[model samples]
Target: MPPHHVAWWRPLFLIALMPIGVLGNLEGDALNAFRQSLIDSNNVLESWDPTLVNPCTWYHVTCNVQNSVVRVDLGKAGLSGTLVPQLGLLSNLQYLELYSNDLSGVIPVELGNLTALASLDLYQNNLNGTIPDSLGQLSNLRFLRLNDNSFTGNIPVSLSTITGLQELYLSRNNFTGQAPDFYNLSKLENL
Candidate 1:
């Protein structure tokens, strides 16, 4: 057999570990998940570099004591691009505030992975498309804001699935119709 034959298992093992590697570690998963989204959201702010030492301490990045990224607030910093699907990987993300920018494209359905999200703010931007129904998956969401955009569609009934939702804002958009009534939603302190 060729020298690569025995090493085949190594690649296979690495491949098999990819998903586990992504999900097992929260910080790794979050970085992988938002990798593309962050890239699209701006012109700078690349992934980890020795020059930066730690990415969480960057201007807009916020992290917990464990050095795990938690929030990314980049509002009106001249960011421009479409929403990428990789953002859904941030399982621990609580807030994603990016307003008054020039972002466009569909809000990826992958964001539903952020079940721990508490707030999601994307307004006064150039975004357009359907609000992902997967948002209802965020059981810990307290606020969801998407206004002053060019989206065209009805509110996803999945939104009502969020039992812990306290505030839901979808004003000043292309949404047409009444809100749907989802089921099994508890802790509905506010609408």
Candidate 2:
């Protein structure tokens, strides 16, 4: 065999020898972590196979043209689990819909890393803990609904920084302090 041919095939051989999950996509891993944490009695997440290259083909997951996860629509899926912090790894994620489930625990502060996020819906769950102040980092967020949960403490003042926020729902919670003034949220249409 020619030296040039050997070099070309060597890389392919090495890749083939790698373990099954070695080349798994980061986004897939993140979503798998979330799946692992959940108790899906209805098998709604049955298609969430971690062995897949990317999570784009998974049920309830949507990907953009670039094959990066852009949306996760699992609302009212009978899922009960704490939201995993690893979900923050999806940098291109624009929508996260996990509402009306039995999810508990605090919203992972790492979710603030999703700078592209446009909506975050976690309403009517059993979630507690103060909303992470880091959520203010989502400059592109337009809809945020955390109503009907057990969230306590004062609303994060940092939330006022999201100038593009159109809908903000903190109703039916146990917020004890006065709501922050969203002077910068001129586009807000809902409270």
Q: Tens digits of per-residue lDDT for model 2 on 69-183?
A: 9999999999998999999999999999999999999999999999999999999999999999999999999999999999999999989999999999999999987999986
CA lDDT for candidate 1: 0.71
TM-score of predicted structure 2: 0.89
Instruction: Please report how far candidate 1 places residue 48 from its true position, in Å.
Output: 6.6
Can you give the TM-score per candidate against the true fold? 0.71, 0.89
Question: What residue runs in model 2 are displaced by over 4 Å at the alpha carbon?
Answer: 1-24
Residue-by-residue lDDT tens digits, candidate 1, 112-188 = 88887898888888788888888878878888778789888788888887777776667788878886874455655
RMSD of each: 5.2, 3.6
Most accurate candidate by lDDT: 2
Clashing pairs in 2: none
